[model samples]
Target chain A: MKKLWNIFKAGLVTDNPLLILMIGLCSALAVTSTVSNGIGMGLAMTFVLLFSEIFVSTFRKAIPSSVRMPIFLIIIGGFTTIVDLVLKAYFPELSKSMGVFIPLIVVNCIIMGRVEAFSYKQKLVDSIFDALGMGLGYTWVLVGMSAFREVLGNGTFLGVQVMPQSYQPILFFILPPGGFLIFGLFIAFNIWMKNRMALKAEAAAAKENA
Target chain B: MKGNARLGLILAVFAAIGCGTLAVVQGITAPAIAMQSEKALNESLKKLFPEAASFEDITETLKSTSKTVSFEKAYLVKSAAAPLGVAVKAVGSSYGGAAKLLVGVGLTRNIAGVTVLELADTAGLGQNAMNDAYYVNKAEKITFPGQFKGKYLTDAFEVKKDVVAITAATISSKALTEIVKTAADAAAAWLENQAAPVATPADQAAAAASGAPAQAGAAPTGGK
Candidate 1:
C-alpha cells in the first residue's frame, strides 16, 4: 500500500505527465479554452489512461517483448474507440464540441508513455493508482488553465457571466497563443513548487541531523 | 525460430481481442449515434420553423433541381394547407474549418431564422457567432445570426454592409453569411422554378437563355 501511495504521489507531483514529463502537450493545449472542455477532456483521458494501463499490465506477460508496442497500441486504440463511440451516442453535443480531439486521444503520448514506462513493469494495483494520480494531475492543470482562460478571455466562469457588464474580455487569453503562454507559465510554476518543496525537505533533514 | 513464432501468435491474439472489443462497442453505439444526429437536425428545423405543423425532407429534390449551389439537405416545411417555408442545411469554410448551419426561408422569400448546427471556429472570437447570449442581449444591440432574421432574399447580404460582422470574427461571420446567402438563393431559385416549371422544350430553352439575368436579379452571383 505504501509502495502504491509512492507511485501515486510520483505521478501527481514528482513525475506529472503534463508538467514534469510533458508527454501530452498537444491535446492539453488545444482543449484548455473552457473549464467544461478541460474537465471533459481530462475525464476522457483518465478513462482511456486507466483502462489502457490495466489492459497493458494484465497482458504484460503474454505480450511479446518484440511486438509489445504494437499490442499496446491495439489495446489503447480499442479503449479510445469505445470512449469515442460512447460519447457520440450519449453526449452528442459534447461529442460535437470536442470534435476530433476524442479520436486524437489514441495518439496522446501520456497514455502510450504510461503503458510503456510504468504499466509494463508495475503490478496491477500500483499501475491503477499511478494512472489515477497522473490523470488527476493532468486534469487539475487543465482545469486551472481553462479557468484562467475562460474567466479572463470571456469574462465568465463555466459560461456564466461573473464580471461586471463593463468588463471587456481580453480575447488573447482564449486564442492558441494564449493556450501556449498559459501552459508555459503553469509548467514553470510546477517546477518552482517542486524545487521549493525539495529545499524545505532538505532543510528539515539537515536540522534533524544536527 | 520457435520463439519468433510464439511472439507472432501472441500478437495476433491481442489484435483479435482488440478488434472484437471494438466491434461489440461499435455495434451497440452506432444506431444510437445516428439517431442522436437525426434528432438534433429535426430539433434545429423545428426551432427555425416553429409554426409549421409538419416538415417534409426535400433534400434529394432540391439537390436535383438546384442548378449551381450545393446544399446538404433542404426540408419543405408546411402547415395544413400550403407550403410554409424551406430549411436548407449548408456548410461553409470558416477560419477554423467547416461551419454547418440551417437557414429557414419563409414562403414570402424572407429569412425566418438561421440556426448554427455545428461550428469549429476559434474559441473566443469566431465562437461568439455561436453564442446565444452574445446575440440575445437587447441592450448591446449587436447580434450574430439574429441579424440575418427577416432579411429579404434579394438583398446582397454583405457582411459589414447589410449585416454587422462579429467583432474580430469577420471571417467566421462572412463564411456564415455566404452559406446563408447560398441557401437562401437556392431556395428562391427552387421557388421560382416551382412557379414556372420548364415542361416544354421552348421553356427549357428560355430558362437556359435567361439563366444569367435570373441569377443576377434573384441571387447575387459573387461571394461577398
Candidate 2:
C-alpha cells in the first residue's frame, strides 16, 4: 500500500509529467477543447504508455541499444493505431474531434522518452511501476489544465454551467492561445513555488548552523 | 579501427531496414486511409440530400468554379435530387482562413442542402457554426447561387436583400453567399448554353409551402 501510495504521489506531483518534465504536450493542446475530451485522451494515452512500457521492459535486453529507438516507435505507433481504430469504430464523433492527434501519438515525446529513459534500464516490475507513475502524472496535468481552461473560457465544468450566469467567461481561455497562456503561467507558478521551498530549506539550515 | 568500421556498417544496415519497414507500413495503410477519406466525403454529401444516391468528383479543385468575375473560377458539385433540388456553400474568410460552402439544388431552388467544406473560424464559436447544429439542423435548407437561383442574371437582388448571413460572421457569410451565387451563375451559364432548364428559388412560394420541416438553410444569404 505504501508503494502504491508512492506511485500515486510521484505521478500527481514531485514528478508531474507535463508541468515538471514538459512531455506529451501536442495532444495537450489539440484534444483539450473540452474536459471530456481531455479525460478521454488522458486515459487512452495512459493505457498506451503503460502497456508499451511493460512490453519494452520485458524485451529490453533482447533489443540492441542502437535500434531501440526504432523498436520503441513501432511499439508506440502500433498501440496508438489500435486506440485510433477503436475510437473511430466505436465513438465516431469523439474520434472526429480527437482527429489528427490520435495518429500523432506516434510522435508524442513522452511515450518515447519514458521507454528510452526508464524502461530501458529498469527491470520489468520496476518499469511497470514507473510507467504507472508517469502515466498518472501525464493524466493529472491534462485534467488540471483542461479544468482551468474550461472553467475560465466557458464558465463551466465538463460542459455543465458551473459559474453563475452573472460570470462573464474569458472566452479566450479555451482557444488555441489559451493553451499557451495557461501553460506559461503554470511554468512561472512552479518556479516560484520551487524557489520558496528552497529559501525555507536554506533558512532552516542556516539557523541550525548558527 | 576494425571495431569502428564494423559498428558503422551495422548502423548503415539498420538504418536501411528502418526505412524499408516504414515504406512497407505506409504501403499497407495508404489504401485504407484513402478509402476512409472517400467514405467521409460521401457521408457529408449524403447528409445534405438523402436522395443523392451518388456523387462524382466533377472537378476536384474548388477554385475553378468561380463566376461573376469576383473570385477565381471554382469547381462544381452537382447533386441530382428533385422537388427541393439546390446547391449551397458560403464563401469568404470565416474569422481565419478562406471560408466557402457549396451545395447542390434541383427543382424550385428551394434549398436542398448545404455543405461547409472549408472553414477557419474560432474553434468554439464560429467553428461551432460548422458542427451538426449550424450545418445539419439549422442551415440545411438554404439555397446556393444566391442571386442566380431566383433572379435572372438580367436582374439580381443585392446580397443584403437576398442572402441570410450568420450574425457575427459577416466575412464568412459574404464569401459563402458569393460562392453559392457564383456556382449558380456558372451552372446557369453552362446549363443555358446546353439549353437545359434551371430552376431558381421562389422565397414567397416556399414560405407558403410550409408544413414541410422548417427550412434549415433558407436563412437569407447575407449578414444580420
Candidate 3:
C-alpha cells in the first residue's frame, strides 16, 4: 500500500507532467482559456495516458526494444482516435470547439514519457496509479489556469457571469500571450514551492543528525 | 536475422491491432459524425440568412459559369417569392492554414454577413477575426463579421483601408477579406450570367447601351 502511494505521489508533485517535467506544454497551453476546456482536455489526455500506459506495460516483453517506440505510438494513436471519435459522436459541440487538438493528443510527450520512464519498468497496478496521479495533477493545474483566465479575461466561469457589473474584463487574459504569461507564473510558483520544501527537509534531517 | 524477423512480426502485430481498433471505432462513429456535420451546416446556413424561409443548393450554377474563383458550395436563399440572395462557402489561406467562411451576398449585390465556419489561425491574433464577442464594447476599433455586413462588393474588400484589420493579425485579416471578395465576385458573376440569359435581344442591346455604367459600377475591380 505504501509503495503504491509513493508511485502516485511521484507523479502528482515530484514529477508532474506539466509543472515539474514540462513534457506536454504545447498542447496544454492551447486549451487553458476556460475551465470547461481545461477539464475536457485534461480528461481526454488522462484517458489516453491511462490506456497507453496499460498497453505499454502489458506488452513490454512482447514488444522488442527496436520496435517499442512505434508500438507505443500505435497504442497511443489508437486510444486517441477512439477518444476523438467518441467526443465527435457524443459531445459534438466540444469536438467542434476543440478542433484538431483532440487527435493531436497522440503526439503528446507526457503519454510517451510515462510509457518509457515509468510504465515500461513498472507493473500494471503501479502504472495505473502513476497515470491517475499525473493525469489529475495536470488536470488541477489546467483547471486553475483556466479559472484564472476565464474570470479575468471574460468575466465568467463556465459561461456564467460572475464578475461585478462595473468591472471590465481584460481581453488579454484569454489570448495566446495570456497563456504564456500564466504558464510562466505557474512554473515559477512550482519551483519556489519545491525549493522551500527541499530546504525544510534538509533542515529537519540536519536537526535529527545533531 | 532471426531477431530482425521477430521484431518485424511484433511490429506487424501491433499495427494490426491499431488498425483493427480504429476500424471498429470509426465504423461505429462515422454515421454520427456525418449527421452532426450535416446538421451543423444547416444550422450555420440558417443563421447566416435568418430571413430566408428556405435555401436551394446552387453550387452547380457557380461552377458552370465562374472559372477564376471556385467555392466549396453555393446556396440560393429565398423567402416566398423574394430572393434572399446567395451564400457561398469559401476557403482562404490564413497564417495557420485555412480559414473557412460562409459569405452571404444579398439580392442588391452587397455583402449581407459573414460567418466563420472554421478557423485554425493563431490563438490570439488570427482568431480575433472570429471572436465577435471581443469587439462588443471595443467597437471604436475593429469589428469582425459585423463590419462586413451591408458593404457592397464595389468596396473591393481591402484590408485596413476599407475593413479595419485585426490587430497583430494582418495576414489572417487579409486572407479573410480575400475570401469574402472571391465569394462576392463569384456571386456577382453568377447573378450577371443569370440575368443575361433571360434578356431579349432588343433588351440586351438596350442593356449594353445604358448598362455600360452599371457594368462599370459592378466591376470586380471597382475599388481594389
Per-model lDDT: 0.83, 0.61, 0.80
Segments of candidate 2 deviating more than 4 angstroms: A1-8, A162-167, A185-210, B1-47, B50-63, B66-102, B108-111, B117-121, B131-224
Per-residue lDDT tens digits of candidate 3, residues B1-224? 99898889989989998999899999999999999887888788777788878777766445412222246788877776666778898766668776788888887888888888888776546776777654622746435776888898888578888887887788888888888888877777666645543235575455445534444443332111
Could you tell me which 10 consecutive residues in candidate 1 chain B have the lowest summed lDDT? B215-224
Looking at candidate 1 chain A, the ten consecutive residues that score lowest on lDDT are A5-14
Q: Judge candidate 3 against the unseen true structure and give its global Cα lDDT, from 0 to 1.
A: 0.80
Candidate achieving higher TM-score, 2 or 3: 3
**Chain A TM-score, structure 2:** 0.84
Models ranked on TM-score: 1, 3, 2
TM-score of each: 0.88, 0.63, 0.82
Q: Which ten residues in a row have the lowest lDDT in candidate 3 chain B?
A: B215-224
Clashing pairs in 3: none
lDDT of 1 at B199: 52
Q: Following a full C-alpha superposition, what root-mean-square deviation does model 1 have from the true structure?
A: 5.1
Off by over 4 Å in 3: A161-178, A195-210, B51-70, B78-83, B122-126, B136-143, B164-171, B196-224
Write candidate 1's Cα lDDT for A47-145 as tens digits: 999999998888788877789899988988999999999999999878888977999999999999999999999889888998999999889899999
Candidate 2, residue B153: lDDT: 41
Model 2 residue B5 CA deviation (Å) reads 12
Which candidate do you rate higher for TM-score, 1 or 3? 1
